[model samples]
Target: MGAAGDMSMRCVLLALLTAAAAQPEGPRLISANVGIIQVDCCFNDTVVDHGQVVFNLPSKCLQLVCNYGKIIPRFLGDPGRSHCCEFDGLLYAEGAELAGHCVVMQCTRKGWIPRGDIDDCCKHCSVYDDPHFVTFDGYRYDWHGYCNYSVAQTDRTYNPEAGVFSDFEPCFGGPSCLGRSTFKDHKHTVISLGHSVFNLLVNGDPYAVPLVGAEPVRCSSKVHPVLAWRNGQCTMLLGSSKLMVQHCRHRLDVWAHPTHADNLDGLCGHFNFYDADDFTSRQGDVHPLEYLPSTFPHSWRTLDQTDYRCRQCKSCPPPRVERLCRADERQLAKYTSICEKHLGSVIDRTEGLEGYLETCVFDICMMYQDRRNDREVQDWLGILQKNVNMAHMIINLRLGE
Candidate 1:
């Protein structure tokens, strides 16, 4: 129509049409200035300062940032097993102190989170001076008892919800602190089968010594005895490992038939195994089998196994043989069953891959440190985990009987 507004619009539309025709997707034109734009509540740090408000900014800054808002999440890494982080249930690394020692934190969590100690700035893992403690009534437990006990640095108080007994008290004394309540009328028999010796228990006594041609001998009431099973052979204390290993190799697996002891040379051998309570005598002065000096290449002591005197006693007639068939098979199967059950339980209770790795990976690796690389470490870890559990179960089952 040749009107002033119509002429101006025609000129603008003709210029935009020419520019839009050059591109694959045509762009449309809009007014340079528009109505007020909405503000974003959550925004990226790069777009605006975390605390910056769009309304407070100058018009130029607001215009520049008008369409650049984004609600960025706290963490941006892929959520996968490799990205999963974990902390030890009992200890966490805190920043170093001025003294140059790393501080630790005590805390626990059930699942993945962006940060630790969400309720507070500080994060920690519970630490204890003594890892093992007794209950009010006298049951003992270590860090592994997390299933049934709460973490308390020095407090031994029981928690009912956690299944800890209220009356179990902590015991701080030495081995003698174990009273008859733990084991009453204990009897232990050590039958030497020519080169190897087998141990069995009745009540709480474990002093039955086997002979070659005579009846099995029981130690005198005051006589204390320490029995060791090493290299698959059993021996009384004060026997040399070299001689025991030499004689017991051929007869390692054979069960000792009840017979009188003709000579001591036939009885001693390098022991490969032992019960948890094997080292202690009736007098309760000796250490546990795991703590014995032999484990560390130290010299053996007669007094360590005796509370009063260290006199060697004569061997006696063999007692009646009991449970003569498939003893080793029975023992091995028992260990295997206990190990499988406990390992399955561990896997089920663990939350994630990282959680499982944190719980037992170190112990498993350290157990077979002679090996190398990830594959070897993993294989050994699996083998050792099962073996360690089996060994522990054997100890308890044997001693508890």
Candidate 2:
């Protein structure tokens, strides 16, 4: 071979090596030699040991269907809604370009495949593709928003038979300015309660009780007060407001009932007012389930004389008010009566109640006191209690025999 030819070949080889070294590490070459890409970007690439593939998406554009299904992406033109479709262990990627768009897929023997062009992964509601907002139960909202106020709402109906609500109506605003819908809020409220109850039951009360110890645990039940909204103010649900001294015996109870700390000094009250801040401004705030009375106090009166007096004294409205209905009174009366008539010895017959109450009251009280200054903490406790109550209702429904 000639020296000129050899020199040229060496120069060409050097140039190729330099070009390869200059390329950025982020993008995949997508050539025969590169079948997978792993970069420090948002996408999480995964190839299961069992030959299945998994990838992380921004939650807005793509979602994983079933655990083992193949994934495919589709793209349409202009404001297109793109998605990753999963089929029999295979994937298809398609891109969309139109606003208010979605990518749809059809299942076939060949694997899950994109349905020609123009179909969407979402029906009724537009696909949520924002970086910060996400869809839960078909409502899109930024979880970071104040008290979940960022959640978007749409007009929809509930179908008890299917155990799920129907698709939401098209939101009037362009996704960002939508208000939370009534149905979505209600459903989410129920779900949130269930989750809180499950956590407390698993990690708070039931597990806190000691199995073997010298201080054998004893649990007792009592009735806690119920508060509701009436006449645009916070008041007792079914109890009367007028005081009955000698002739009228039933107490004309008020908000912040058991007004005296002495009333809450017993075992049942200990759990009821089990706050570390029992001596502070936050006293009587936390009422945990483990410490909740088995029997609930009920009345047919609606006026809140005590709360009214306080409101009148301050000449101000209640700080926070919740919507209430008469039906809840029956529920309150029924649940409170569950263990009411039983003798004090019944605590000995109750299995695991003592331990649960002790641990739950201790943990929750300490937690409450620690965060007593933070109003948000109290808000969280109230929300969690609602969930626990719902969970109890569910269990009672299933095993109320």
Candidate 3:
């Protein structure tokens, strides 16, 4: 076999080992390909993990589908009103892993929130799509106008209606005003699709440069934190930010479209944040899932929280706030009793829980390839849910009655 094939096998084994060590009870997720899962035989767990009660696994389970259910129509957030037709009885139908590790079998009070419905039953709520700011793309538009990419400047000029974007740009697909250039301040080309990458890979030809790794820089992809783009070279450095969180081994997002990143045949990378920044402005904030945990308002949103795809992406995710939902004095006794019964163990357990929650964030993003598109989203979600359910928690979607 070629050297590349040997290397791929080695990497797969290494990843499996690493995951087993990290999560003892839960299986580690692996994408054999975009639509297909690895389906490792080792991941069938005999123990069930639940939210109200915590349980650890006797052994490691790799990848497996644990739960399967179609979303009830009222549970899913629709532009206008998606009748039961929209609510297919399947989760992880398309893009990703199951829900969280805790709280199995029911929707968590703290679980994902969707918005927009006519009345309570949403028999009459306006469609999820609005004509004004909503674009053909699914990315969200920021109403606060604070979404300008400039780190320092506030009132800078940006043209949203520029021409088409070049292929091979490493971000949300569709057209964007990539704010100002890290190359030059106030220059629009910084946000131009493939401009930064083209400059980095210039043989004076953008397309001529083959994808350097197994992955191509597709839309919905993340960048390294400190990306130095100039003179056709992108020196990616370690940065915690979404635009540059890559591990240097570049690959296409699970959602990388067939054919190319952009070029409207099927409209694959069309819904960039720039594209959808304002689509739901009149309806909801269309918060990126990454920022869903932040205390952003969701008056018009379909759910109070977003989907795994939205939560996992780095699209300049909203600010994360520290939340403290203090236990009322009345209920403190219940929690206190447990804490007192297992004081030292409780401290350790709490710390472990916090650690898992942190890593789970990335798991969420990596789970769904193209999470925003409501079209046939259930299939994508169903697969992910099955994976999650097998190793992690039981997931449920609930609507306010």
Predicted candidate 2 versus true structure: per-residue lDDT over 88-185, tens digit per residue: 22333443221221222232332222233322222111111111111111222111111111111121111111011111122111111111111111
lDDT of 3 by residue, 224-245 (tens): 1122211112222111111211
**Which ranges in model 3 have alpha carbons more than 4 Å from their true place?**
1-184, 188-401
Choose 1 or 2, whichever is better by TM-score: 1
From the highest lDDT down, the ranking of the candidates is 1, 3, 2
**lDDT, candidate 1, 201-260, per-residue tens:** 322345433432111123433222222222223222211110111012111111111110
Look at candidate 1 and tell me the lDDT of residue 138.
18
For all candidates in order, the CA lDDT equals 0.23, 0.23, 0.23
Kindly report which residue stretches of model 1 are placed more than 4 angstroms away from their true locations once superposed. Answer: 1-342, 345-359, 365-401
Per-model TM-score versus the true fold = 0.17, 0.15, 0.17
Local distance difference test, candidate 2: 0.23
Residue-level error in angstroms, candidate 2, position 60: 4.4
